[model samples]
Target: MKYLYYSLALFILSSFITPNDDADYEKEIKEWHKNRIESLKKENGWLNLAGLFWLEEGRNSFGADIENKIIFPTGKSGNFLGEFILSNGEVFIEAKKGAEIYHENEKVEKLKIFPSEKPILLKHHTLRWFVIKRGNKYAIRLRDLDSPFLKEFHGIETFQIDKKWKLKAKFEPTVGKKIAILDVTGQTSQQDSPGKLIFTVAGKEYALDALAEGDELFIIFGDITNKKETYGAGRFVYAAKPDADGFTSLDFNKAYNPPCAFTPYATCPLPPKQNLLPIAISAGEKNYGNH
Candidate 1:
């Protein structure tokens, strides 16, 4: 009995000295999350996004005038003299005499300004906007539009900061390239995804196919936490490039809400059909405000 008790004590001592893998992983996840929140709150981050305007197919006049086809802010009063024509997937703005049009900090002649096949950069006060292409369509993205970082903007809320939600995911290649359809308010487009992320929990395995967004793999998932710990419809996650062994890190601590979570001006994409997870992901940002 004495020997058995000594062995039991030794086992407990060794367990404490070595520590548990889960505890170490949780620490890393928390640190990553802290860094991520700080980055998003930076001046140029997505939190600063404020508007999205869709251009009409033809000439659209913009000014402070209530009767103008497209209206500008009150600060831009009396500056608009002509209209911008959208024809053949291009925008042409004819500026009036003494009017200024700047692209990338340089003033250019505006008589027959054929701006890039992209959105023109415009600034008034601290606000900035640029034209962006979404599936052959053009729209303007505004930053610092009516920015009241304290009044209009509220910080992100999170779950109880549990570690079980931090998961290890595995990559599973598809037989061939899979095209995933994204349905959003302003755009519906198909994106090609290389494969799916498979992970196991509670003795069960689940998979979520990843869609490419610029250099990152974007994922939208719905879980039991929906409407309880996270947004009702779903939440988003961005994964970096896989490592040399085809392994990727999926830190749920970095999960965030779609742009729609903050404002009505955004047209965020919904999760594709196969990307939904069957388990509850009780990590990351929670629902914001009433919406």
Candidate 2:
């Protein structure tokens, strides 16, 4: 009789105890979203992008003047700030006499812009520019540190944090597969694919092709939410590489808009046809602004 009483007492005590696991999970998601916002507000983020001008094979004049081959925002620079010379596939930038162009905080009258491990950044006042090569094309990507987009950015909208969107996935390896990825610029490139991530939602199973990105798997996906609440092109998410057992997790709560959703100047990759799901995935970030 004493043993029976002790068991009853323990059961009552256990019923009063509440697990904080859900609360802790919600906090973690909020912290991750905060870091995402911080990254987008940084100098190298997509918010500052102002222009993307394709460079011609010869001299391309750049300034505030309408007649210049590459026109900058009026009143931001002199009427004739500089010229970009493209010769035999090499690019060089020469600053106009009164234009004070600085690279790494050092004044530069002329400098080579291409043939380097990283894009060379040149700054003038609040404007920053660098050369970007995409496929066989080269272009000048310009950024304004004081861009209205950056200043007006509030925060991204996200779905209610729910643990149901966190799912267990199986990684099925297809090691030598290459997927065709189409960019916003109408260029299609082949990217290396490591495998497919198969997961189930609402008792239905779906698979997404996984792209190899360093130690993580990069996923560009679209769903029924795209037509309404999310970016039309798709959302991007990163999943941890599968372990020896070929298992991983797909946390849709971490999905986010591509750079193209934030800026027109960005050439973001679209989701492959096979990755588009017919089901509603009401998680992650929603579309920002009218874009």
By lDDT, the best candidate is 2
Q: Give me the candidate number with maximum TM-score.
A: 2
The sequence of per-residue lDDT tens digits that candidate 1 reaches over residues 1-291 is 999999999999779864676577667766766776666566556666766667788977755576767665556344464566678777666545554545676654442333455446665455565666577776656666446542455567776566666667777766467665664664667667877887777889888888778877778887877777677768889887567777787768778887677656566777776666777777788888766
Query: For every model in order, what is the number of clashing pairs?
Result: 1, 0
Candidate 2: C-alpha lDDT: 0.92
> Residue-wise lDDT of candidate 2 within 61-155, one digit each (tens)?
99889999999988677788889998877899999897988999888789998967787999988889999878888899999999988999999
Estimate the overall C-alpha local distance difference test score of candidate 1. 0.68
Worst 10 residues of 2 by lDDT: 13-22
Q: Which pairs clash (backbone N, Cα, C closer than 3 Å) in model 1?
A: 119-131
Q: Global lDDT of each model? A: 0.68, 0.92
